[model samples]
Target chain A: MNRTITVRPGLRDIPQGRLGMWLLIAGELVIFGAAVVSYLLMRIRYPEWGEQAQYTSTALGALNTFVLLTSSFFVVKAHKASLAKDSKNVVRFLSLTLLCGLIFLIVKGIEYSTEISHGFTLRSPGLVDSGQGVASLFWMYYYLMTGLHGLHVLAGMIAIFVVMLQVRKGKYFHRVELAGMYWHMVDLIWIFLFPLLYILK
Target chain B: MNIAHHEMSFWRRYIFSTDHKVIGFQYLITGLIMAAIGGYLAYVFRYNLAFPAESIPLFGSLGPKEYNAFITSHGAIMIFWVAMPLLLAALGNLLIPTMIGTDDMAFPTLNMLSYWFFFLSAIVLLLSFFVPSGPFDGGWTLYPPLSADAYINTEPDIWKSFMTGGTLIILALALEFVSMLMGGINFLVTTINKRAKGMTLLKMPIVVWFINFAVIDFMFSVGPIIAGAFMLLLDRVAGTGFFDAYRGGDPVLFQHMFWFFGHPEVYVLLFPSLGVIAEVISTFSRKALFGYKFIIKASLIAIVLSVVVWAHHQFIAGIDPRMATFFSIGTILISIPFAGIMLSYIATLWGGNIQLKVPMMWALGFIAIFLVGGLTGLYLGSDTFDIYVHDTSFVVAHFHYTLFPITFFGFFAAFYYWFPKFTGRMYNTVLAKIHFWFTFIFFQGFAFPIFFLGLDGQHRRINDYSAFDSLMSSWHISFRQFATISAIILILSQFIFLFNLLKSLRSGKKSEENPWKANTLEWQTTSPPPHGNFVKYPQVYRDPYDYGNPDMKEDYLPQNKVI
Candidate 1:
């Protein structure tokens, strides 16, 4: 929550620098959109691949989903508090956001450890036990999408920690709202990712 | 107002230059040095093709493997490192701020970072040449399976190293994207929100509109391909499976992601140069730009079509026939907007008192040459013509014809047009004209013959081909000899531009505030602009091309002058 100085008026009243943050998110969305479309298309072409997807731990995925949904809710609350300039409430909600993210990472780490111990590695029959195409393309997507999302999770924590430094200094209070907005976005992405990866199956 | 007499010391004034003019020239010199390397590689491979067994007089003997290595590195350097940086960035960075009324880029530190990142990307690319088994041999496209496995071929390390270069290229692109993005945001804001008090959108120059659209197009289109490059790199060298065909990875998926950026990447390099020619045409002609509104609309249309028509490159790559038909029609339709732009430029000259300056001469050349290139592309766009000629020399020739001339001829026009203002000295017009004429002639002499050879089915990127007919052999040999001879001339002429840079600065004729007698606001500033441009920023009162206004005493009216 960079709470020091706010960005000055930019090219637009919304502020061009602020617009850049949103536009970069839009650009990130498009990249994720391409990857998502490829994922769905791969599934459509190889229906049996779902068999491989089903073997993964649905419980841990659902747990992470709950964690992210809670994180998003907290970040939204933080935005509201910051906008009101209620400093204490803003800090409270932001801490909740951090807590939820930590829980989600721990849940994911456990899921990966269990999967690895069970021998569902990228090159083994544990991936293709159900059928031929099921093991190959299915596990590949499993690793790619989750791996990418998990990396984003790691990135989100770094961003939150940076905001925490700002919070202590009481700098960029308005930027806290902006950072909260980004935090909510990261949580929101997992909401979509969770249903597709775990709950729907 | 003495730009030459800065109180600041050497480091502050020159190295960390905040002057837009200095930064622009910095981009130019860096890109020019890279062009020499890019062109030399093109000659080496071309010579190997024409005389497979023989030694050349200048550079000596070439081995078969080394020949293909040159071809691979040449394409990579020319497309990524050379053409885009030199033609667009070098020229675009220079002209954007000055042509608009801004003194410098919106964020000057980001501007400095863009050049530094470009320097870093260049180093990464150059380092690939020193890697074991030499630089990439998998073609600039870097297709997978061939590019994927560590031991698929004996030369896997080179493919892998080049992929590393591709990653650096993306980083450089991200930096460029930030700079262009900041430039566009600033240009649009300035043109829309900060234009000298009264310069309305309609009253602003067409170049602003063209570059604005180009910058917006670049911001959105760059992300997906950047993500794709990371994916391709992971699969190629890092033991990942993003494009690995046997590892449940889809090769076709790589094609999809690539052409998405790959298609618009064409216009990303082009629209700025086109903007240059469009402005030059109206500027030198001493007339109001003919159909300025229509030209703006035409450029907007080009940007839209660039994104929608990307799949044209994938016509024969096992695409579903229905999708292929959809993209085929798309490829053909893009020509309509381009044709409209051409017509508007030609009509701008109609009934106008034209100045046949060297800049305008190159603009005229760009129009004719790009027209021929555009028309030839229609042949490749047709599904039937595309099937036989997809990867053949025909495709290669078409792109070279389209992009090569634009990079050299069109961008150089912008360079010559602005040299006086940026450097505060007049380039010798005779030397400028001589460089233009000789380079244009040799440019055609080198690239034009490739189209015929392509039609005869000589595929690109191969080292030796004695298997083709004797007619093909003779044509290839003769073209190579001519291309090599002419390439040396092209390389040498660049030094003339460099010499003009040094000589014109110290002793060339002193230039007036408005040297070209044009109506753009940048001209209203001192010969080379100060740290903060304008003595109380001039309020715009007329169109950028209000050349023959009967109310004005002179043939040209400055954009700032009121009735």
Candidate 2:
């Protein structure tokens, strides 16, 4: 009978979920990497972009970077806690990770409103007639890159939340680490985004 | 591996099924239905193109606006809906698990989710046709500035509408990409970590390897386009300047992003079909695959090279001269590995006892047709020649030559080859052969004259060729007439296949477990294999293609056969 068989764990001796996450990371890098490369190329061609970059508040960018890094650290802690089978610590670190994500989005939201109040908007032909081509292009990249990064942050938080739910339900604790790995990727993209969009000049 | 078999209700068994086979059939049926829609759209436009003033039977006269919508949706539906679903999703899902000796996909829930995503996206796409702006008419490329702003479409109806067709198209396609992404992850994870005992990477059938290559290629290449689609959606809805030229955004960036995924996307579609051809050729030739290692290496080389050649499509779109030349060279280089694969298939056929069965005929037909397609692609790959053939029927003909054989011929081959094994019944051979000849002849007749019309300066995407400003020669009209006739016949011939498929399901000759006497792991299980595929875990002992082995008593040695 077909019931007389049992598949060995890891047919190739590699954890399938971890491998899937890594493959996803590579794909995400290519996506975000391509966008960043486009930004860098545009900046290189248009040198006035550096002057435009200086107008943005570097303090907020650096603060978000610190926030993301802290989240990554906590997610790592959650992964370690899960591996050590400490349910309480896993929940604790994951909650911290989720908190950091909220803070990052709130700060990003504040920055966006401030920039809009300063008349740096993404709405259409006004950007071209603003008489600063490089600045317009700079804000376009800033919003697109940061906006995409923020979406990633949101996705990461939801994933961390789900993993936390699973942990609380007392099942599938290994998913905590896999979800953390994805969270770290979100953090890593922001690390690049911080330098390129905010401080590169 | 032994998996516990559970008796499930009809909803769980079929509707929300996780069985790879059931999902494969779901994709097949859905793709066929969509293909009919795409094919009908072709007929509508072709009729209008041929006789611009005349009204058709059921549908009334189609205006230029309607024509544009038809052509655009036709391209999108045929590729995304029909071809991907039929060739990749269906065949890959159905065959990968059985051929690789697995119980089910690594992530069964994710597999189910992929199909549901596809279903939801298809529903959205269908609904877009009924929307106020009508479906997107920006061509399948969805090049921006025009695609970005509804006001730029020049259609009287769309101009007044804010909720444009392009947004709906983008949303539907984004969902489709997500579905494909999920399926890709499953394929990769399953193949990498779920192979049977003693079935190492190299020991896998060429089809499994091809699926692996195609899935990974999809995972790597599809990201940029996904990002681009999101950006384009934002540009349309939120007034972002990603591809809006008035806002200092470069439209060419969208083209780069689209084709970056676009070119590799064709290979992603082609590899699985080619994999099917490899299996069919080896099986019918009664020979081990010639240069199996070489084919794998060539596929990998082609996969790597496919990405760099994306800019060839952009040569006429105002790219740098140096970059154009580089892309032209890169495009030309892709044909080398393909030629190697082609030659290897021919080598497999050399000095072998060949069976001209329905599947074999289709496989051999794939080689003959794809050769023409590949050669003509070389013509279009040159930057100089592309200047003349750009947007012409010659380009259209060349594209049909490339894609039609894969989607039609390869799909039919897979259908016929695996029919008995999956359906547990044999189709009428005579009917199948008739279906093949009619399809092959009519499709060629349909595609070939379009090439001449293209070379004669007949442009594509125009609603009416009879307009005074048209650059078409007088002879081009007759060619169009001929093409129209051929297409009708080609479409009509499909009924024979449909009849054969439906008839074979219940009343045709019942199939044995190994009716074809092939040497694959799938043949070891019962036809229409049970819930848990194998009665005993199959331990692989030899290569899948062991045809005509001198030491073997029988002509073939199954992969799990014990000495």
Candidate 3:
């Protein structure tokens, strides 16, 4: 009864963090995917949504998308550096990714303000009169999708901030890759959200 | 690996323990407490329906809104707070790590966090009852328009109460979902990465495999509902038009999203209990489980098909006609996998050395009761038949027949079966059997007549049939009294269980390592195995059930025993 046994790992054997993160990714995709399907379903019924799409600032949206894509590159670099045990580069790249998240948030804030300033709001007073019936739905999805994605971005930044501090203490460096993967997920969601919200029309 | 070697403070050892078993009991105790609360709510509502003119003691008076609150809270609490935790969280946590020969979960701290979040969710649910608006009365499904309009244009204080209470229920559900998500990750990772030497996937117990399948299904299924909940929350609090038809938001969209999660949630509850019955029956019958591979395939089929059948719940909600037909056929098709599983259980029991232990009685009871439940499902699954029984007592009876056996009988079977191993004490067998008979008979007596009332077209969620003279037939009133009496008797029988459980814990015969001589890894270790579980890591040599093997001298052969 005192004997200790070792299990043989199969082909898919991997770290818990990577496995858990991938499963989390699958669940997230469904959530975002549900919203996407809803948008497409409603869009088919109401072709007039093209008018509501005009209220969004495509330039700002494109800028934020570029920021997220670049940040994802930094996240990949961070994962590579952490695998090499280069704690400095892990912290540096993670900091850069977090910075990109902040920049995207700033650009998003500008786009939202610009839209709201023109009275293109979630509760705009004259939605029924103007017959933006379908267009209002487009904006509704735009705000909800982007807003949810933004929360994910904020979560990613907080995760990286903690990982950065741990890396600075020269311990728990494995967390850097995990945090980077999460940040990349945020970027991945934005990659889907950008064109659907800003450029689909 | 010696768990007893290390000593810790009381707080660290129990209060904030990270041990899987501790967390398992935490889930169990909390779920039971919530069950009691939910049951009391049922008692109150049943009494109201039974004696409409009379005011019950302790809970003096019941208004229409108050009656709605009781029903809403009862459904939500029982399913989310009680059944989910009891089956998935409690049994799943206690068994998976020990059975798979893992010292702890892949992430034990995350496991602990899951329990605390569940605790927080329970507290939030209880708090909703105390709120000024007295919990959301829009029913457990929380169909929108009612749910959406709950927060609008009431008196300022009352409006605030509704807003707070509604949001709390939604937030509590969200938290529970996340908690289960964390638990699901641990289950998947542990099963995939942490099995003992030679414990191949198929060689594992059916209970472990079913739980693994269940967690994965739950992971994918819960997503859309969480999204829908957020949209509903926005509609309620933020004035977003997600479900507000006045703002061009179709409430039916919410139905699609909700049932997308809701229908699969039934399987999430069903699979684990099915797994439990399989183990109990095989172990008692002294034979290998029949159709082991087929059972696995059947579970997988059920999982895949569950997602497509959700619209069956929304058939009469003004959904597209083509969509209704598609969902109807899809729902009917799901019966095939369930039939396969049920048939496998009966086949397992055929021509075997039978032992009618308390656990086995409950297992056989589950099959008998669930068969009625499953057959009634076919009736409701057919679109034409469903149009007649849609919101009637028939639907309620059918649902209880399906869920009651799985949740109550299933959990009780597991409880009696595993009590010896975890507690290192054998319960009073006579008392256990008595509890079973009372529970089974009364449960049937309670739910069976609801079918007749439903056929009479008595709508559900009504506080009192006596109040509705137009809809009330003599049969409806009489059956209400009968069902209510059966329910009271059914609830009282649970006291026999509680008394037996507590009395046995204090004074009972000590148990051996393998009290029932079952051939599984958890039984191979000492009764109440140490924190690291096994003194030596178990290496499996055969499938879990090798009962009455001709080559073996004993009636059962443990998995770790080399042939």
Candidate 4:
């Protein structure tokens, strides 16, 4: 089959893929923003929530934030490499990004287990039994915000892995930038989540 | 470049097709089916309302639980499954590409995926009815504490949480939102990236403009609800008191989040319907849309105001009086822009060779009926007045008047106007006219009397109004019975439309390409445009509604015509 590649410029200078990704990022930001806003409202409403916030290990959160920020940097490197037609560096940088995402998840897993084992679970059955159920609301927001951000990290990893595979074959190099943008969004959300959940108190 | 059109398997071409038109039809057909189900739910509830305990034909005796579930499902199905899919998904998919003179959506596969996700959501909604808890009786708004706490205690098993009707309904809604978000992204990208060479932003048809605006609004507004729904879900299943007041959650927060999206969602549905009305009115009236740029500006103002006016819905939900006043003012002020748009439509119809075509009839009907809907909204918008009639049948009547005209009236207008383009055939006009009259008359018969019932202080969502002595007056009973009968006829009259559709598809007159002689690019192409929409890609030269130009020999000019 023969087809003509119509060279009509898009209405704007931005590539369609990038524009679409930007719109998706904007949507994702609002979802996270609303959740964060809800958390803030409740936090302000109940000052005692800060007492429960003392249980969160800020060290683990800082470590995970560093992991995510590094992953975002790796993704940017991969995007730059793709633009330079350096397929090998693109694949290498993307692997590093994926590894960072995995580390972030693993750290998140450890945090969850530690919290849960200490009876700071989502339902906070132990706290509820002690008539401290209201304090458990802090844990609920923590888990929700972090859990949602973790899922985005996982999604970003899968996306990067797919783009990495294609980059190795030197196919669809432009997708590297799209995947990078999404990864940055994942990192950006974590940046917001880290402070909102762990650092605020 | 020319590529050979390869023959595709029926499954590939029709079922899982990536073509925007085929996907549009998928959404349209699915939406129509959901509308039927929603209408059936309405029938059962209306019957229950009118005849109280009487067992109706083909349906069993109605319990209070069943009545609540039916009303909830009817509202959910009508708004989410019927209106959103029909107006936003179907129309956007069908018209955005064709109107902009593009071959297909920017991302065809993503478009297909959006439809399938919507299909999945519809399935989940249907499945909710079969769930043991009986399909979420807490109202479409799903106010928490009631919605959150009811079913969690009944089922202790963690997996059983997924099967409860409330959770399922929430899941369905979340899935539906995801589907629309994907579809919205595709629409925004396609309109911005894929317009034909000369199709500037303002040069596109009003419907395309409205659709993109609606999609943008949906994208911005839907996020809060997605977050809210997730929290509500956790409240139900995980025992995380995000909305459970006893567990330190604020139920009122959920209300705020829901209405924040909910109010904008009203305009999200209305904008597309308004766009359809604009096209139908202009085409039949043989005029350029009056105050085209002004209408766009007014709609933009309305969209901005819609976001701020959501608190009005929660005026009686224990909101501060000062905030209520602010919201009430915002709500009332928002109507001015809409009124401007309405006046523009009316002015377009003035002193033109108005052809009262079937689509034009629906457009005129929409303006007349929706005016009542809009004007009545002002009364409800006032905090003082709403305090008296909050959640009464009056609010119900007002919204029905608004939504029915926007969803069904606007739908029929676009459906009839584009029937020739969709099927390459002419529907039997006499049959369509009869269908319209039956629908119009019975619709007014059904909704108009309910306004009086509401004024007489009949509250909505009551299983048995007879138990309340004040509500059982002769006036109330008569109007209730009249509305029920009219509703029954109104639903049955839709059969005429379905029959006309089927009959026209089978043996209607083969249509010329531009049956309506409209100036849009869609009509410039073949009747039921072939693969890629156009034989030769169109170069749009003028504004979409280039009608009634006295200098033009034909009295109208197609957008592609260079003359």
Candidate 2 per-residue C-alpha lDDT over B449-500 given as tens digits, one digit per residue, 9 for 90 to 100: 9988888788889887666445545677778888988988898899999899
lDDT digits (tens) for residues A40-102 of candidate 3:
787787777777887778888889989999999998898889888888998888889889989
Clashing pairs in 2: A5-B2, B394-B454
Q: What is candidate 4's lDDT per residue for A1-201, written digit by digit as tens?
A: 999998976456678898899999999999999999999988988998988878888999999989888888888888889999999999999999889988888888998999899999888878877988688888888888988988888888888898889889889999999999999988888887877778877
Consecutive 10-residue window with the lowest summed lDDT within model 2 chain B: B153-162
For A58-109, candidate 1 gives per-residue lDDT tens digits of 7888778878888888877877776777767777878888888888888878
TM-score for each of the candidates? 0.89, 0.95, 0.96, 0.98
Against the true two-chain complex, what DockQ does each candidate achieve? 0.30, 0.47, 0.49, 0.65
Positional deviation of B166 in candidate 1, in angstroms?
7.4
lDDT of 2 at A97: 90
* Residue-level lDDT tens digits of model 1 in B1-563: 64564788887667677665566677777677777888778767766666678776567888876776677677767766666766556665666666666556655665666666666667767766665656656666666655555234222454445445444443444444544544444444444444556667787677667666766677667656666666665554445565655556688887887788778877877787788888899887787887888888877877887888788888888888888888889888888988888888898898788889988998998888888788999999898789988888788778888887678777788778877887778889888888887887877777777787777777777676766564455656787667667766777786887777678887988788887899898888887777666656677777888888787689888877766
Candidate 1 residues lying further than 4 Å off, grouped into runs, are A1-11, A80-96, A121-134, A156-160, A163-170, B1-22, B56-60, B150-196, B470-476
Ranked by TM-score, top first: 4, 3, 2, 1
i-RMSD per candidate, Å: 3.6, 2.0, 1.7, 1.1
Q: Chain B alone, TM-score of each model?
A: 0.92, 0.97, 0.97, 0.98
Where is model 2 more than 4 Å wrong at Cα? A1-11, A124-129, B1-6, B150-162, B468-474
lDDT for A51 (candidate 4): 83
In terms of docking quality, model 3 is medium
Clashing pairs in 1: A1-A163, A2-A172, A3-A171, A3-A172, A3-A173, A4-A171, A4-A172
Give the Å shift of residue A188 in candidate 4: 0.9
